[model samples]
Target: MSKKITLFAKIFSISFLFMGCGMAVFAQNKTEDENVIRCGVGLLSQSPTIFTKKTVSNVSVTASCSDTTVYQIPVVFHIIHNGEAVGIGTNIPDSRLTSQIRILNEDYRRKEGTNGYNTDSRGADARIQFVLASKDPQGKATSGIVRANGGQSEWQLSEQAALKDKSNWPKDKYLNVWVCNLKNGAENLLGFSSFPVNSDLDGLPTGADSTTDGVMVCYKYVGNSPLSTRYNLGRTLTHEIGHFLGLIHIWGDGFDCTSTDYCNDTPAASQANYNCNTTYDSCPDAQGSDMTANYLDYTYDACMNIFTQDQVARMRTVLCGSIRRKTLWSEYVPQEEPKSVSMSLYPNPVTNSNVIVAAVTDNADVTVFNAIGQKILQKTFTPTADKITINLPEYQLAEGCYFLKVVQPSQTKTFKVIVQY
Candidate 1:
């Protein structure tokens, strides 16, 4: 089978419902661990998310945001632990947090050579990038990884606002992410996120209140933790962030075949998918098979790799239209400089011929790194042409994943490359 698993190609005309956004709690890949988040599957036995009743609007999604502008949003993580030592339990290490950010960028930007990269025509780079806040609300330098003692072992789902309030930041300025113990009695809570609301037109209630306006992810699923198993690969946050940015579950969670996610490109499915079962088609009436590979679905992290073009259009619309999210892009006066230019990589899973291609719009410095961040190859480009090609056989590197970084003055973009030969 082709690596690109595209389900349908026909354009779908969907009446985008642009009102009443709310919270979305997700239950991803089931794991054998004690702290399993039962977002309706094992323990909850109910809908993992409580979707708000959508209202009709004639707002054209594509009209709101059309430029290829990469919106970079600043994010802060509040690590709430129960007096555990740093790097233990809920008090996760810095590496784990950074890894989660890396996964987010890979998924949102569709960087090559990562699990997030996909070739399906439906798949699109959201043209969104997440930056860990280098400055705190107090204008002080911060790692964006704030560690504090929540003074509790585990929290209940009802305490969403309370926990967030304990370590709060302005939601308009920073995309707040909470990492803590949420293994409720009889079931563990994986993660949940607040949906975006377009409050510019008529006053509509966003799924989340100001107290719970960001994303809350269980400590276990925050990063590439082995204990998470099927839920690993840091996709829990990716999924929740989708909701945070105005995406609905592909299944619709409406308990019927007629349920729709408002994105025309995504086919209707009856229910959520678990693990990597991409073959199952819940909605026979729909044109495409279940989008098991979509970021909005309940499939395992490794199983999912795409967000259709319309989905991308919807999210960009939300960002540009939503009152809360519209400010997020410009709220942070960065301690870390933003990337001014971007580039793309091709033939990831590098071919046997070992020719690598990097395309940029401006003059750039191309460098290659091994699995570990070691610089193995370096070259510069003046944009005499838009494409730069390099032969990898000269380096004689082993068959594995590597990083290709392109630097253009104040901007930098990195692509992951895989070697199969």
Candidate 2:
């Protein structure tokens, strides 16, 4: 909720601007203490404040507001680290990235029974989905994740232009997000994203679409974990993407009632609420109370769960109008969730008998690999019911960490499984 509400209704040419980036939209204040956890959002100068040569009065938003088609966005996660090993320091593992992606789908889709679900009448399924880029700009197959050594320990928010140069794909083709140590001194800033510029404009900053367009996220907050209790759920990225897609803070980035986020459904809040508390009413005089649960606010990960109809309209409109955004979905072919993406092993130490529990919808080839990269077992298993339970009884040889690989027609995925005696 750091940035003030600023969205251009038209992607016109010859207009100048930035969003005011009001949520303190470009900066996040990290807490210094170990026991206490907190974060803050701040405004930035390079931020684009205005766009649209002139408001296109005839544009219709009816199709956007009632859009039922689930638009898929191709995203490229650039892991910028100082040569840290996988799963260490700023270089996070693929599973954590997968976890973060799953959370994005859950939150954006608002699937029931998940943390992303909410009962609010204004709550909506944005219908916009995210997919890792399956192919690179040069027409090469990729995981959509680019990991590189930045040769630096940390990056400054002001240096985003240079930081992005470390490993960036074409912005008009993919949604690039740099995950690294955004540590200014000892503080850990969560993340920030540059607002989308109208490509139809001229006389703007040179290479505006390529230079200052993308997102920045700290490594610790890239994925979900109980250890990251306050910002644990990966909602940080979700909120920033809301900005990337054109949704501003619910409070309008001010205490005055006249300020607005441009969404009619969201009730105006006097200020941003950072905690999980939701009953506070910053604006009683307004129609409804504060929409603390709205993803645009700086609420805790757990407190966020909804995107209103109007908010969805704003985002979809951006996707349609912004030249840098409208074609991102075409960068990759969308596929259904991987089968057995996250396999769970029962009874920590794998003995003579081990059970694999997961939500597998179709047939898949399963293979178990030892720690040394040798295949220990290979079998074909088909699930007969919604709840899948497969038994593997060959863990007697060693007591250590192993991996399970699942191969399907569409994709191949691996999971970490522990074997014990």
Candidate 3:
């Protein structure tokens, strides 16, 4: 089993400069636990309030997954432990993990019959897939999972400690997630994503993408298990993966009531709520209760079974860009082993300035995309010790989401950026 990391006090110098500006756009909160859920949304919105409506129905929520191209995602599981086998309750069964992956495909692509969330079950089946890597950072094939014994794992702002040997996986090839026994007050915290395109691991050289840390329950309650249905539902991974792909909670942070979860389509709830029998209306001024059914909310697994079209669009944007896009359906087939190039995007979610691109080896042309899958920017970078910058000022992009791609000689890197108005 992996060692758990604490989170009640993990601090990173993130900007709160615009936190107060968008409080009025959300619905009124019903309580505190709900507020914690809502605070998760607080991180998603840029507006003061989010509007809603009863019009959003099952059809609106259903996503299309007609495209069945398998997306091959190189996965690296970091098993942090104090003194236990890497494969513990925390380590989900491979069969269960595979089921969860299938769920992601079904949900994201809206596969029929398996649309557990009751939303429209149609779209390019994200044709994407994940595999446990057989190689380590040293160029050895791995089981896509890593295990380390003993380490101080805490999410405290300043004490964001790293394990003893945290540098064995290669970020450019694998989607790294550290799984462990979450320290006190960290369970339900599940996982959090490190903004992609940034390789600086604040404390260690763990250039992985997101951190999936939590308590591992037994088979009766863990992955794909109905016993622990609510929390253990595949939804936890789906939710965290959503964050990995750049989706915020349905409600913005808890600073105020109006902030959105960053998605223009998702309603802004004053605060996020937990299981509720009564249908509470949030932001009555605008529309429906904050999308409690959204995976980003604090609802138990069974309660969350859908992702809206807008949410789908946001995720597709990541898969379509240079970051995770190429490995997505139609881009990369399972027939051939993928060849990746090293690249980076700077000033993600750029406003007036252009995003800088850096190629690790040889310089290559790059492409940029908007929310609806339209190419907005394109350029080529020459091999240079310094990065090359591409101006997207002409796109005149409004406040929304976007993706950037940079192709290099080895592995390709894609990044999802949010444009703030």
- Give each model a TM-score: 0.67, 0.67, 0.53
How would the candidate models be sorted by lDDT, starting from the highest? 1, 2, 3
The global C-alpha lDDT for each of the candidates, from Candidate 1 onward, is 0.71, 0.68, 0.49
Off by over 4 Å in 3: 1-70, 86-96, 115-117, 120-128, 134-140, 151-161, 164-168, 184-188, 197-222, 225-229, 254-257, 276-278, 322-421
**TM-score of predicted model 3?**
0.53
State residue 62's C-alpha deviation in candidate 2, in Å: 7.1
Best of the candidates, lDDT: 1
- 25-107: candidate 2 lDDT, tens digit per residue: 22222212332212223445433332222122222243453265678888899999999898788888887788888899899
The per-prediction CA RMSD against the true structure, in angstroms, equals 15.2, 12.5, 23.8
The candidate 3 region of ten consecutive residues with least summed lDDT is: 1-10
- Tens-place lDDT per residue, model 3, 285-384, is 7565656667777666666666765666555555554343234223445466554435667787677887677655677667878889999878777756
Worst 10 residues of 2 by lDDT: 8-17
